[model samples]
Target: MATNDYTAILNELKGEITNMVVSSASAYADAAKHDAQALLSDMDANLQTWTQQLATGEISAQDLAFLVKTQKDLMKMQALKQAGLSAIAVDKLKNDVINVITSTIIGKI
Candidate 1:
């Protein structure tokens, strides 16, 4: 795989999130999918940069995860909130998304 390829990294990131959102049985699954994609898109630049760093050994998997978590502001789970999901559930989902990011990058590498 081309570690320098941002699009490839993005596609993998998106695929993981898409799978989670689509597999859910929630009534607001579509809205959740939209929200998730929006967050991912908003943070695409940072993700791409970090992915390259991980591939080049400039950052370890733990460092990548730390960076991903630092972007919690991007977790704006509007759909989940509107669907009455509690803060705990939303937080879990947020971490789930982060895990998706880190694991996907590691897998790609």
Candidate 2:
């Protein structure tokens, strides 16, 4: 192939790769956001249930407070876990993209 042909192909490949990376990253972020929201909703529901139980004499005030504190701690841990997973996912995506681009360029040459 001519120089121009190779250049054109490489440019097209680069554009496609860029689009893929952007779309993938957006999708991952959306998924992470959804998961976080779901977690929050669940925590809210649990807190409500606990409060109701306490009002009904099912649990003592001390127990309620402890439960609430424990739940809050769990939520914090879950959030941290999610953030760590997100970071790992982003790193993996970066590495995968780099590998793909490198292989493509190597093959082209």
Candidate with maximal lDDT: 2
Cα lDDT computed for each candidate against the true fold: 0.74, 0.84
Per-candidate count of clashing residue pairs (backbone under 3 Å): 0, 0
In the range 14-68, model 1's lDDT, one tens digit per residue, is 8888776555436355666777787778689889999999999999999999988
Alpha-carbon runs more than 4 Å astray in model 2: 1-6
Candidate 2 structure quality by residue, lDDT tens digits, 1-107: 68987887678778867887788779878988898899889988998999999999999999999998998898889889878987887787788777777877777
lDDT for predicted candidate 2 compared with the true structure: 0.84
Candidate 1 clashes between residue pairs 3 or more apart in a chain or in different chains? none
Show where candidate 1 strays beyond 4 Å: 1-4, 22-85
Q: What TM-score would every model get versus the actual structure?
A: 0.37, 0.79
